[model samples]
Target: MTDPGAYPNPGQHPSPHGQPPRNKRRVWPWLVIGVPVLLFGACGVAVVASVAGGNDTTVTTGPGDGDAADGGAADRGPDFPGKLDDDTAAPAGATITRDELAYTVSPLEAVDTVLGSYLCSTVTIDNVGTSQNDFNGYTDWSLQDTGGAIRDATFGPDRPMLNSGQIAPGGRATGSVCFDDRTGAAPGTYVVLFEDTFSLSTDRLAWITTL
Candidate 1:
């Protein structure tokens, strides 16, 4: 004794499949028949999308901003210090022979994956200052790519940064700094940027190099 109008009145609008509308069919058998089919349909769609590599899912998939065709020539390396020398202890690398301090980046290596890609190098800071020089290893360096992306040194399990400490006059400190690499359209050149102080300025030391 069911009130058809108050419940699922299939007599008014029958399901296209001729099955009772779920609300009208409030029966355990119907629930058991419906739930798994719904789950299976959802799973099937997800599987097909993944296999097709479709970006329909929540995770994003697309090119980065720097993926321009001109090889990031616009984002080329920063300017090297005017005092930098072409030949130094590391002929294949760069040396900034300035008045107060001499900074060197050498033993450069191109690292792979790294959660991505990046340029790896050891930086040496020599204090030619009149007094002891305080140095924060990573603060003294930056990496710029051809795409105009300026990156700071990354320190993690993937790459450990140099220790920050003080160097007496004529003393030197060495540490590692990494600049993240962008894939896709980019120029072959990159610039190593450095500043000896906490203040910001256009006069930071730079070394133009390639990867």
Candidate 2:
């Protein structure tokens, strides 16, 4: 107020009517910006941590992984490794054993002899029948490829045929079934079939599964 061109003294500026100005540090700027910035950074970190810790992985079943069924020709509701009796035709009195056998199929990831492109799986068969019948891994089982091509079952030299002259009733057999997709095991649905004998009827066991 004394001199309009003079600058104010340090920390004490001239106020209106010649009053002294109050001394105060500049902090409101930092409080306004810094507090929100810190909160935003914390929330961002929390979101990243939640995403990293969440279990988002899925275990996919490859061509021949997991349970194998004995589905009929088409995917007629759970035709995998289960009973294959023809409900339509049973031997009059004995209830015609139909296909009283059950099978489990597990995919074989890598095999020494199996071609790199070929798909392989292990089959476990449980014969619940009362009679002793033969089991042939190769001639008994079959695979349907993505293109609807039927591939015959075969094994490497080490893979033994799941057989004995007598897979007695209640007997179990294990064998390996390999398939050549011709185009490799592409992504799609494949069907596995099993029959004690290669008969042309849908009475055999069939399973529909994805690759």
Candidate 3:
């Protein structure tokens, strides 16, 4: 028989000085793979943290911001409620004046229409500006009830509608502005808000009266 102790067993190697046989597998290959896996895990965690931080960012706006004074409706912020909030409430028949423009609104009157019923109010717009200004009754006026509900002007009534045209300096125009008569004949608190889009002023006029 061949010399049995001359070579070690399969998958093992002899050690010096008759020490235990060593396994053939080397640890370097496992170390190379494990190192790359650890690095990729750390990079994934960092990417997730960065995305989470970006989602936490926020933006805010205030009254004194230049958006209101600078540009048209497109420049306004999403929270802009079509009118400014600082306008004080004036009683009916009171002349509330804005930049070079004066306004007077009368009490509400009920009118029946074939399409529907409506509440009408007479408004007088006096242009005291140095230059001529245009007033559009359809887009310039709105009414708010005590419940914070806003109503736009409706042309379904029989009364003479507000004149929409250019007014020269030191001139005035008068006519009726009507709204859907949601509240019955009993008078309810109403607020009339007027914003002259033709003028550069962002300020609006508000009149509080019974409808």
Candidate 4:
């Protein structure tokens, strides 16, 4: 028989079916000690893993630190022709010559859409001669279809206006043509024309088409 209030006999373990004597020391002390130790060990492992993962490593390269050597030596000279002197003479038969006029259809090309569409054309006149040339009184600019049907064109504010205006040598003037009305014309080859009063000549500038 065992006394209820008495501790179990020394060197004799009591059966678990009987109520064990209470440990006066609070069990919360072990919980507090174990939780902090486990948390600290987990934090230490996390820090070690972060450092070992090399998440902070960074490499930097300076101007000349690569396999390719710096080819930009100070002694290297320009590969193209430099500025020409004012006294330079023009080549033979180059008197007041006009360059091949260039025209562009914007948005550079045509747009393909099931609905309505619009596009602009620009003609660039470059004065490559040594002397200034007057561009005044140049008016008739139009777009024509392949079948010889002429499309009426209007000049916007950016169009080349001669009104006694002169473009200096090496200067350029841009004339714009916009097409909004599409009645009989479908997507096909078209020719843009620029007629000037200076020489009574007409220039078939560009051949473009729509999608």
lDDT of 4 by residue, 1-211 (tens): 8675565556555557876555478799899899999999999998777545421111112224321111122211112122112111111111112232212233212323454443345445556567776653234455555454665454334333323366787787655555433544455555444344444222222333443
Q: After superposition, how far is residue 36 of candidate 4 from its true place, in Å?
A: 99
Which 10 residues in a row give candidate 3 its minimum summed lDDT? 54-63
The top-ranked prediction according to TM-score is 3
Give candidate 3's error at residue 66 in angstroms. Answer: 33
For 76-138, candidate 1 gives per-residue lDDT tens digits of 223332323321111224455444555667644677764776677787777866888677766
| Ten contiguous residues with the weakest lDDT in model 1 | 54-63
Model 3, residue 31: C-alpha shift (Å) = 57
Clashes of each: 4, 14, 0, 1
Clashes by residue pair, model 3: none
Better TM-score candidate (1, 4): 1
Which ranges of candidate 2 are over 4 A from the true structure?
Answer: 1-75, 78-98, 107-116, 157-164, 198-201
Stretches > 4 Å off in candidate 4:
1-119, 136-138, 156-164, 201-206
Question: lDDT of each model, Cα atoms only?
Answer: 0.56, 0.53, 0.64, 0.41
Model 3 stretches with alpha carbons more than 4 Å out: 1-84, 185-187, 198-202
Top-lDDT candidate index: 3
Better of 1 and 4 by lDDT: 1
Rank candidates, TM-score, best first.
3, 1, 2, 4
Clashes of 3: 0
RMSD of each: 19.1, 21.2, 15.9, 26.8
